[model samples]
Target: MADQEETHTNGSGDNQDSPATAKKSGRTSLLDSGEDFEVLDDVDEDVDDDLPPLEDAGGHKKKSSGEEESAQAEGANVTELSAPQEEWLDVLGNGLLKKKVLEPGSGPDSKPQRGQNVTVRLRSSLADGTVVEEEPNLSFTLGDGDVIQALDLTVQLMETGEKALVETDAKYAYGALGSVTPAVPPDTALTLELELLSASDAPDLELMSPAERIQLASQKRERGNVYYQRGDYAFAVNSYSIALQITEASSKVDISPQEEEELLDVKVKCLNNMAAAQLKLDHYDAALRSCVSVLAHQPDNIKALFRKGKVLALQGEYAEAIRILKRALKLEPSSKTIHAELSKLVKKHSEQKGAEQAMYKKMLGNPADSSAQKRQAKTSWGVSWKWLFGATAVAIGGVALSVVIAARN
Candidate 1:
């Protein structure tokens, strides 16, 4: 949920019914004017994908292998951490309560592994204790069925421009999986180090301002970003498409190939976005072809793998679905969402195998689907003739016991 923003009344307290006051409060206040949060730079996570972040079920956030414990130790005033780090941040604190900006993400929502995501790193640890695991960026699109409940709650604390590190229990983090250590069960209490990177969708604003040529492109990207957030993949794709063309035209800006990597990522996201939109619209073949195209460029892309796997599943290619999803699992072994999906597919495949065997048995016996003759054959479920008789009470009828009772009388 988006937080309600409060605007400070200017001194002299005259009737301040001006749009300037509304604009001054940032997008947070403007949201009350019914502005779309998706169009803004900061994408909110949905409320429903309330599962653990990793597959380990170890009651802990999966610590990324890329990071290690920094020399920074012990909690300081949320404002007084470090001046240099502070420039990379904006903070809000009222004594023990505070909000700090963490990291920001790209315009397109892609796999957690591939590109840099917009993240709001937040911290609320005990003054004496240390944070056990590093926090991932949450500046991506959050919504129903996308992120864990704890993160959802954390993001909800800030209005569009507000930021804070809310001290919530393990009940919030991992939804009961408290610690990153698999040994610990869920619901254990823990602290978070949260930070908000930016409040609006102007992530590229700093760059856009310097180059006047890219202003229109930035605007188009922002609009595409909004469409992406609202689940309007088609419009989102169109918005991104226009932005891409503008970028191509604005090659005058001196950007290294490494910088170009980020732009390419945005393009991949657009194509993936288009394919996903197509997938949701049930254009299975088109989705599959689009995913294949994305994979041609980024063979290791987990998002394309997932999309391809879904397309295969829709095409009744269970084996292919299982294969593609397994590859994705290798890329992010700790991802619980992927593991859950794989589990579902595995169970489905197992059931399908059993049904196929049962069908074969019925064909050999020349029996109908509901034939009792086939039931007794034990096609995996083991519903044998004897078991069926026992279930129906067909054996040892009550008459025998009644006859014995009559004899005793």
Candidate 2:
């Protein structure tokens, strides 16, 4: 499932907080725009961190980097620690919070030891307590190893409707992993709290209704995209496969055929990506199967048709290659890559389409060579960095203002 996530903008700068405005009587004051914050004092002090080196409040060590920003929407708290709170702070020297356990569960792969899945929502912070990353809501098979070890440990200890703070060094989590994280140090340690809102021990049903399966599959697809961007194409293919399976199982959505077509369109693209990535890994049969799956959903898809032609060419079915390639070219005349591929096939099968195959093959070009996907990177990529700077400024200013207000204490 594709997610239309909103883009974040921070004007011209990032990491700085929005300007703070104040009014005294009829006069307004805007001195060096910054953040205004109230220091929170009543925090739970009883927690665990066996490491003796931590210097947290009451000697709690932090498991991850970055102060937890108080995100009211996600109900996830972000706070920075002085030398004191670092005990519970498990910030990886890089930025990401190594996936920590949100609940203790069975074990990786739903092993009798790992545990079951859990539903949760988290607003995350990178180093220095920046709330730039957040999963407003998410579901994981918990101990099934869908998340890091710390989150699983924390999740298992939590009862239904229970929430607690849990942290861990990145060693047991994702370490200096660069392919997925933009600036994270490879294998860096991480820390976070598990606020359990709900826990259920339901059976894992693979035969659920198509609609429900579609929803679950979509979540997998989104997670796959996040990982794919991190250059984990294999995971992306698996996630897209799950989505295609759900769609293939059923086409009726209790709606009109027009609506069904729209849903199928989504599935077609999922199948296309699955095939593309699988081919990159040299899994020809699997790639061909995925392309066929897309045609079953929507025969008019030029991309899938083109991909199918490529698969045929790989199998040395030059005659079929020329036919499918020609069809794809008719639909997308402006595609430079498609023209390149058919040129070769037309030569392999001189009599594939009698007289026209040669002409069409030249027009289709060499179907063998694939062009890079023409997709625009998320607009937020640029905006989010600027926002980060702006937010940081505001946050620092807010901290200073709080220090001034609480000096009397």
Candidate 3:
């Protein structure tokens, strides 16, 4: 899918070779801004050695075997004083993910909720112990598509101060297209060490600054793009929907003109991308609504127009589809994608019309066939009438002859 952007006037002081210019020059880049783009090429060798021993909520550190024995001697339950279990628990029961708790956390009754902000320290490595990603402290909204599916699912199962070693299948992590930043190979599994630092309710959108909302919304859109690339259309749709919600909420708050424009641009992009994802899921009506919403704000948005046309065609509204596609083509006369879509829609429209005509002919008898049958029936009736008249004449003639003979006698 092509990335959509609004045309912005460069001020005299602005850099002529801005990142925005570079992004606009290509159709492949899903992100509108370069501020949050990340690459994880550098590996911290001391990452393993730097972290202190895992500790629970009450500052109780994980104990060694001897320490465990000492704690048991002090009347602590032997089971509770024992080291974290080495036995791996299957998290999903599908063999895709397996977890072994290294340090059990306190507060068994509390865990991160959906829509809450979660912070964790993460270290991911390949099966051979080559670290691909290491973050001292990473924070994201739980269940917001901020992280990989595996991390999201794994963290929700954790409590504050919990430490676990998780084995992840590629499908739950990066799928086939692995990270370019981390230099991970395609379809490679990884070992993750995660420590749930904390979880708290997400900040209200109204309470956040306009810039914060824009940044968060953009992050969500980028996440959605990742899901889209992985062919996870349902997840992609959810991410985009969340982005749209953030932008819509941001619009209500009093904001500067520049912020408003930026928010609108992001909103348009999210709506367009969401429509594309929804279309992939065969959600024709929802896709149509998304496209329509984009057009209402940005009438010349070629992507939105093209997608709307596609959804309409899928719904068998060929005439409207053609009109929408033609408009899109007109707006971007040089866009090969728009031209190709329009051509396809036209072909489909013609085929659909032909099919409809054939179906009507079957439902209502064909005019030519009807006329021929009528003529055949008319000719048959004429022959029968002529035969009846001839028989009557013969009978009448016989009767008259008999009467004449009687008079002569």
By lDDT, the best candidate is 3
* lDDT per residue as tens, model 1, 60-159: 5655544323322323324552233312211122222223443332322321221123356644343346555555554553332123334543454443
Q: Which stretches of candidate 1 lie over 4 Å from their true place?
A: 1-221, 244-256, 366-409
Number of clashes found in candidate 3: 0
> What are the Cα lDDT values of the candidates?
0.50, 0.51, 0.74
Model 3, range 186-235, lDDT digits (tens) per residue?
99998999999988999889888899999998878777766665567777
TM-scores of all models? 0.36, 0.47, 0.70
How far off is residue 313 in model 1, in Å?
Answer: 1.3
Q: In each prediction, how many residue pairs overlap at the backbone (N, C-alpha, C within less than 3 A)?
A: 45, 88, 0
* Model 2 per-residue lDDT tens digits across residues 1-409: 1111211112110011101111112111100111111122332324443234523325455534333433433454545433322233333333332233334333232321233556755544444665433554556765433454456545544445443454455543454352243234565544454455555563443455445655665555555444343344565565666656655664333556664564565476577666655655667889899889878867866666776788888887888888998988888787555677788678767754565766775677734332322122345566788899999999999999999989967
Score residue 271 of candidate 2 by CA lDDT: 73
Model 1 is weakest, by summed lDDT over 10 consecutive residues, at 8-17
